[model samples]
Target: FAAAQLQADKNDVDTRLSQVAETTAAMMDDLKVRPALAEVIKQLIAAGNVVAYLPQDRAPRVYRIDQFVLKRDNYGQFTDIIIQEKVWPSTLPEAVRTALGVKLDPNTDEKQIDVYTVVEQRDGKVTHWQEIEGKEVPGSKSDPIPTDQAGWLAPRWTVVPGSDYGRSHVTEYLGDLLSMDDNYKAITQFAAIASRVVTVVNPNSSLDVAELAAAESGDYIYGEPDTIQTLGLNKSQDFAVIKDVTATIEARVKEAFLVANYRDAERVTAEEIRSQSEELENGLGGTFSVLASELQQPIAARYLYVAAQRKLIPAIPEGIRPKIVTGLAALGRAAEVNRLRTFAADAIQILTPQVFASLVNAPAFLSRLGNEHGVSSLETLLKTEDQMAQEQQQAMAQQAMQAATPAIAEAAIGAATQDPNQGT
Candidate 1:
């Protein structure tokens, strides 16, 4: 349905096009974009910078920071990107083959070609094309796409002012990591030395070195009582110190990466749990925000553009940008659910059930909790306010009928006992 038709009757339009959304989702699943997205996030964290581009003609491509060059406009927005891909010649367009003066070959499957795809916003238009060996490919020129449909996404782990690249968390904890590595190496070498068994021998001893080496634990050697003794590798104390230091360094590094687990006693207080949860949330809050702005919204907008272009969906209304809910914020939302659960539990403990019922909108609370807990079709699962009102009215009517039933029965009995003819 068109936007006007949708706006005129949202329910009907939604019901009609519901299958479109499902089919689109199924199509996206078939494209296997999730694996590409997972790789994009992996690169974002590992390298601190990643570039993902969605071409209407193909699955999204994830490029390493080294594989692409980028330029930001005066306002620090990405304006130009040149990505180099090692593509197979079989995948290239015929125009590209003609430009390269290459004849069709059955062995194209084994061939590799370096192609450069350049996309940039110029003169208020988004232009994109591909080139091989610095010469433009004849069939790879894209018509001027609207800036909003540019389909380029670059999400970074952490932004550095005036720098195009992002800084990874590993770099922030480099000192701790390096120190731990050295400590581990020292501990390992010391452990190897300490674990060795050495039997010291005197020249006066008659025990043969080969015999002594081959002797089992129960074997008896004929030698002077004090002639042969074991020498201790006394590096245990040094090893313990290195081990302790390494553990501490490891903890620090884990803390920096926000992967450290917070453990309490076997029985922990709600407050303690809440505190740890808040700390974790605060740590992820910034990460979630960065991904929402840098990754989520752009992907949603570009997908909407593509869907609209293909008429799989209606054009979006002006000033209504695509807003993603369950993308990067999933982490934050999980935290929020925990927070809400804690709040509800605390409220129940602090107030009587009656008081809690009076103080809170129970239906609203339950609906929110259900949604946060990822309940599907939540709107349909929960009764609407109108439904509640109708239910209340029905209950009242039933109660009134129940109270009036005996009175009506007595009136009918009196009328039957004293008939109209008997009274006359």
Candidate 2:
């Protein structure tokens, strides 16, 4: 009986050993398959510009095969190939045909279009495939992708950076220019400079060229140089550099009369204007508030005006200084107002001296300097008393006309009633 028990124990041990070997072999297979699959996927992403994300709960072993068309050269030609999803990136064929453009049909099967060709006959012999046949659509030219194929690619194709989708988003700013090379270069240059300008105006927050280009040209941005001098846009952390430059020039032209007065003011000094200008530009109120506050600070306005006439600052006219200063400074305190501030102090520090100097020494700044003391350009620029007189005259005339209109209408009605009686 003891011998029989020992043999049974040995048999049980052998069974356990066999199970262990099978499990080990299965695990090894899984490890080997996993790495091979990952490598293939990586290559697909690089080569085909398509990305697929499979979920864990889905059948992990499943894969698919499909077709795609690529634009190769400037000429239009169609090359057909079958691509396996598992080895998409590495196995996909490079596009060899030149593309003048693409022609697509939503109603037609994409497979038909993928391998389409035109046959030309000469002397009863087929000479060549003259062209790739395409379907014509109304209201628009041939689509780059067949409408039908777009549906298939939508789920799998990843956009390469700075490619179709990227340019499409900024199509408006690109203007009517058709040369892709020129447009690309212009946009890149604009982006590089605008990014730096925004960073300087506000250190906090962030913006990219794409976002800036996407913004509406008319929208108010806080750190924009024009905003700093006009709308009290102290909080503006970012701006479109080209737009800002143009806006500044426009503002200068519109307010040229006032700027001239500020330049001629004799009482204000340059130092005072410069100080107030600094307060407006770098301070919470910015340029606008500084000008407004100057109306009350008679001494300061006079000092700024005197300084302006002495040529202590740039050649900005005096007439526009007070308003410009007020505009520049009007943005008010960060915690106090609702305007957007895109940059921080740190960003402002990053600006090259030339950029900041142009902003600080603006023509409007010089005019404001002359108006600070209220004695010189500030008084001449505002001529507030004269403005009040004209406003009062207009108001009085409107009121008088309002009072007489009813009386005149009543008299006309009375006259008409008398006229009927007189005729009778």
Candidate 3:
């Protein structure tokens, strides 16, 4: 019976996951498309790791740090992470000091300390936490850290992971570019060297070393008339070849980073632009998949967990764990969207009006269609059956009133025409 109950709970969670998949994907889509978020991800890819802190009151904030350590368990889950940061003595709040077991010294007001904030998780829950001062062992415990939060977890702090090998697009191509850059610099230096004019002094002329040095500084040196001839080295024809090579290298780097080349959008048709965009999206498929698994989903889950603990969002449902549905993956499946549209259109065409009406609410269906197409006007233009029925009734009432007006007028005329003489 216990096993059966566990299996039933698992089934319920799976059903809920399926139900919220699209909604989750849309949320992920919105997040991934943000310019700031993309920039952060690019930095993460370049730097190998980035620190992100989720405050209970606001959106998650990312910090670029030069020093940090991360350790993962056998299952490739982060088990221990430490962030070392320097804080000014004055800026350290009393509560923070208490958490770190720092006693205030009025005399050391201007000192800076290296605080190592460590968070350790075991079996998917944070189990150990320490904020040490100057890399010392655990100190005396003071008052319980004052927090409105109920969980043992500290504030939402996370280390956003990058490639496991610490390799990034920038790092991959940077070495080659560095050599190219050096070659350019060398060419400039050589060009400068070639530009130097050699002044040939006559062997017969008596020369003072100081005067000759001064003469070299001036435009013309004292020499026999013919000996003053300037010898200019011909400019190398290899510059064009070098330029082409550098440009090719730059293009390759951009390709690796999935950076788009500048194009004349006004001249290109929408279809062409979309085709290029789809191609680029496909090219980025592997990178996005890795990011979704390693960074995006984990950060989102951590955000949700902290938000739930802080009462910022509704408490998570029992026996249910939310999973992130990657928007990139969903968007890639354009065939699925096309299939859904085709199926719905065919079903609508084949079904009788009565059957369709009984099966689905027309206004609701229209509203959903509008939402799927991102068309706000469609939803606004659609009216419910009740609203349509009320409008029809109003039109009929006006028509009946117009029809009765002429009859009423004729009756009045007949009464007037019927003289009292008829009665007499």
Candidate 4:
């Protein structure tokens, strides 16, 4: 069953693996998380597999293949996992030590020791946990460690598998290209050496070979008749061939990783750029789908579960599975910007009196558009129709009062001049 499941999901798994490899490679250029991301990529390239886990009080941690063992079920879902880690005795909390049933000796020197944590999951949920000391199980089977959250406190491992069984980028993609790159570098170095002038002195010539060689600025050779000749091969053609070969190899590497190449001087139109972007999106669609299903959604669910337990986020509504959206952050943002620009243009063109009059639920459509453009707060930023009406009424009332003020004063003065009481 497991073998069948592996075969069934192999294409999907490989797609996601390729995406992760490409993303990791791209992320090596990010300044904020470059160090950590570079380390993760290095491990992936070296070992072909790495594990990501979220600890209680720290950033997500990555472990190499040697640090963990994984067992997958028939559906290629992780069913059981064991992680071995070394921790200092001083780092363990007293309650945790008591729960583990280990008593530390005060006289014994504090030292690092390996702790094995085993987690078993059933039907996509963690069901059991065991902490073992060396080879001995310390705690009773029935008494599990106390956890505020229902599932394991330690987040279950998320395995990032590379291209194949031995998930390694270096092995799969860079192996041959790297060798070619080295050869190119060596050829270039030799070409540089070959460009230097060589001086040959005839035996009977009245010229000092050492002085001719020592002259820094000029190349001159003195010899009897045609005895001395400059010997240097034109390597320009050879250099061009090597350069072309190296560039082709590099371009292959970049294309494999889905990285854009800007080596050529050919001008590309906006339509071409859009077409290429769409093609890229289509190519990575499988990868995005796999990541959403296998990695992002599960990790988000775990985070929300923990948050709900701590009253950080609202409790999960019963019977409704929370929706988690995940993608490459930079790409997602660009997509959003493009979508909003398109929507704005469409809205401006369709919002004329004639078009709006023929539309149904125009208000709702506008609201939806606002939400899509991330302007759900448009109501707060702009006045409602009723509010605008009220402000217009207020402005009219003030105008009427101001317009009547001069007339009222003129009438009052005329009455004062005509009436005896007003004059007095």
The digit string of per-residue lDDT tens for model 4 on 164-231 reads 12345556666767767796787879778887887666777787777766768766655464666677
Q: What TM-score would candidate 4 get against the native?
A: 0.64
Q: Please, what are the lDDT tens digits per residue for candidate 3 over residues 1-424? A: 8975665465444334433444444443544434535556756667645555434444444555464566665544556667677777667667666666767677754666776666556544553344655543354222332211212221111233442224454565678779678868867887888878786656666554367667544465544565344576655666667777877877766766667665756586756656766776676666566566666665556545554555544565656554545433356335445655776677778996566668864554555444455442342467745689999999999999999999999999999988778966
RMSD of each: 5.5, 40.1, 9.9, 11.4
lDDT of 1 at 348: 83
Give the worst 10-residue stretch by lDDT in candidate 1. Answer: 11-20
* Cand. 1 TM to true fold: 0.79
The top-ranked prediction according to TM-score is 1
Give stretches of model 1 more than 4 Å off.
1-31, 56-58, 91-95, 103-111, 123-125, 268-274, 280-289, 307-315, 322-332, 335-351, 355-374, 384-393, 416-424
Strongest candidate by lDDT: 1
Higher TM-score: candidate 2 or 4? 4
TM-score for all models, in order of appearance? 0.79, 0.14, 0.59, 0.64
lDDT of 4: 0.57
